[model samples]
Target chain A: MPKVTRYDAPRVIDSGSIWILVAAPTIWAVHFLLSYWVAAVYCAKSGSGWLGGLTDPRWIIVGLGGLSIAAIVWLGMIAVRRYGGVFVVLEEITDSSEQGRERFIGHVALLLCALSAVAIVFTVIPGLVFDRC
Target chain B: MRRGTSILFGVLFLTALGGCDGRHNWMAGAGEEAAAIGDLFLILMVGAAVIWSLVVGAAVYAHRRRAHPGLEREARLFVIWGGVVFPVLLIGALLVWGLFLLKGITADEGDLTVRVDGERWWWRVTYETPTGDVVTANEIRLPQGRTALFRLTADDVIHAFWVPALGGKMDMVPGRETTLALTPKKLGNWGGLCAEFCGGAHALMRFDAVVMAPDAFETWLAREAETAQVAADDPGFQVFLDEGCGACHTIRGTQAAGPVGPDLTHLAGREKLGAGLYEMTPEHMARWITDTHAMKPDIDMPPYPHLSGPRLDTLVDFLMRLE
Candidate 1:
């Protein structure tokens, strides 16, 4: 009778998963730049004094910020589920296993999501406070 | 070695402290808007100093102190509180406060309106009065306790109008108009300069922002509205017309309407000549007429090197009497 051997190898991490780590921060950056650009261009093109109204651009900015935060929160939820439904910051997830690497990425993605949410909130403050162009 | 390093740092700190003189100081608080901005700057500076001290202290401790393996929880908490929570709260508050201040200062209208055009190496100023537009150059006079709205534009390239003691800077863009509102609270002469680098002679572009009392400002504006009172048959007037000086400069109530250079309507009444670069005197005026490049390099005014003797003196005298 021939001896039977079991083959075991670490699963390869998919490149598609890496985008989850940067998705939220990228949204935050895009939203910040877009808000500033819209305000600046509008003010420059419209000339001095009230053209349409300050509230028009303010509402647009608020909507953009809200959408960005919602996307970040959704990403955070996905990260939590993929990270074994636990948030770990004090311990390093370095077991030389594929599962451990995925957990590490998930934890980092969740942290980024939280940071992006805070940035989105900061971006919305200008729209709320300034009532003029 | 540590003692030497400490001494060096102390000297550097003292040197930095010496740079807090009031010239070009944004925190001079000479105006209402400037005072508001100064208050905000003071708060931000103090907060930044405290935050810097804490961050540097923690960094030093982390570098020198021995690691405690069991203090992971404390480390995580420190990151969350100091790195995450503190920054978010502080920056969010500051952003809101700054935006509110901006809105307050940029009021839509003011008591008076002044149009300032940024030229190559000077400022073309026009004050809208109840009678008519009183045109002047290189000098801005505002009444104390009254808000003045500045409608700024550039004739050539981009320039920035800044009177550090008054308020924030506003850019003068070509083909577009930008406005700034400021109310002078203190009565004094504040320095004004072009804060943007618009090629040659940008550094020489400057003006004097004089804050005067309301009655005095009214009197000055009244005087500025009248035409030049020089006699038509004056020899100096003849000399001014003969030298083709009228081709570039405009003197009100006379035929010297060229529109190529600053309006010399109220030249003698101004505090300085050559765009606030020199005291308005006969000598400097003569030099400016004879050697324009030496006074303000790259200016459009051609030097009258060929015209000398009593004629040059007469031209200078004619310009000085433009008040």
Candidate 2:
């Protein structure tokens, strides 16, 4: 009998949950597009930079980014529960069982979440910096 | 092998240093904004060099050392500090600095304003005076120590205004007006150009940003605003009219008032001819009229290959005297 730690202690593993791999990046992409759209529309509409230079649109982008990051964090939590720990110590995820596949998906998804979070942060920077079009 | 590598790097460094000189050097520090930009570039270069050295040095050190048991804690600390935090901080600081620099250089207002319209292969320059607008062509003269806001536009396709020694490039889009400000610190003919490729003669389109003393600039402007002193019975003036040159060219205070080409009321007074292509001499001026395509290909100016001998010589002579 295995002395199971909570890392591997899962009740019912979803057999094919590969959508988690793309979830974080998808959120990042959506946030990036929306951020750009908001800024472009704002600048184009008001040439003089009136109404305080993308202030309203910038806050909207911040809210969207916050929501996206939160969603990614939630996805990351799900990945962590199955894969174990923040650090991916696993060299390779070649496990073939239902649990093995779930672990493999979790491993890649966690990395994607970290990358997406970093990308989202970078996207928010230009909005904060530039005061005008 | 190490000696050879060092020699190779030395040669590369020297070669890179060679680009620091000449007229088109953006790091010339001829203007206040240009100097600020030059400082930013220097900082960026230094930071990059430092970062590269650290990364390579770490790799070399790790390579030379024997991997024994574990320095896991130290390694983790190194990764977090060197890999994550350092890059984040460096990029964040640089981004902020760059944004501020951009904001500073892109100031809309200035001590004075000059509007320049970019044509197919030339610049139509207009200086605002207290009396009225003083229009000129090709050459852009700026007063030293005074910030000149440039309102730029294009007649046909897209073009770009750039005085490399003074400041950055700004686009001149058709039907749109973009503004750039340049304050000259040095009194010299720092070369100006049309940066964006427009057509066949795009590369040939050039000008001189002549920084003059404020008083001299005022006197020059006053002179430029006045019309040319064309003699009523000048033979060259008669030839210019007979040849139908007035249909495309304008010589103010004369009957040859064609608002199509450059305002040649004081063409010879300018430093260069053929849109800053040749020296403003009789020889270049004569060639420009007869063999226009030879000097600058694909130009709108029709070549006067038929007109030659004394007629062409007289016309060139008359143009040179307008100064």
Comparing only chain B with the true structure, the TM-scores of all models are: 0.92, 0.92
Model 1: per-residue Cα lDDT over B291-311, one tens digit each:
899888998989889878988
Model 2: residues with Cα > 4 Å off, grouped in runs: A1-16, A47-67, A70-111, B1-19
Choose the strongest candidate by DockQ.
1
- Compared with the true structure, all predictions reach lDDT values of 0.85, 0.84
The top-ranked prediction according to TM-score is 1
* Model 1: per-residue Cα lDDT at residue A63: 92
Q: TM-scores of all models?
A: 0.87, 0.84
Query: For candidate 2, lDDT tens digit of each residue in B1-323?
Result: 99999999999999999988776778888888888888998988998999899999989999999985477767767787788778877887788788777766667789888999999899999898778888889999999999999989999999999998999789999976888889899888888899999999999999988999999988888888889998999989888899899998988888888877899998888999988778898888888889899999998889899989999888888999988
Clashing pairs in 2: none
Residue B248, model 1, lDDT: 90
Each prediction's DockQ against the real complex: 0.52, 0.21
Question: What is the TM-score of candidate 1?
Answer: 0.87
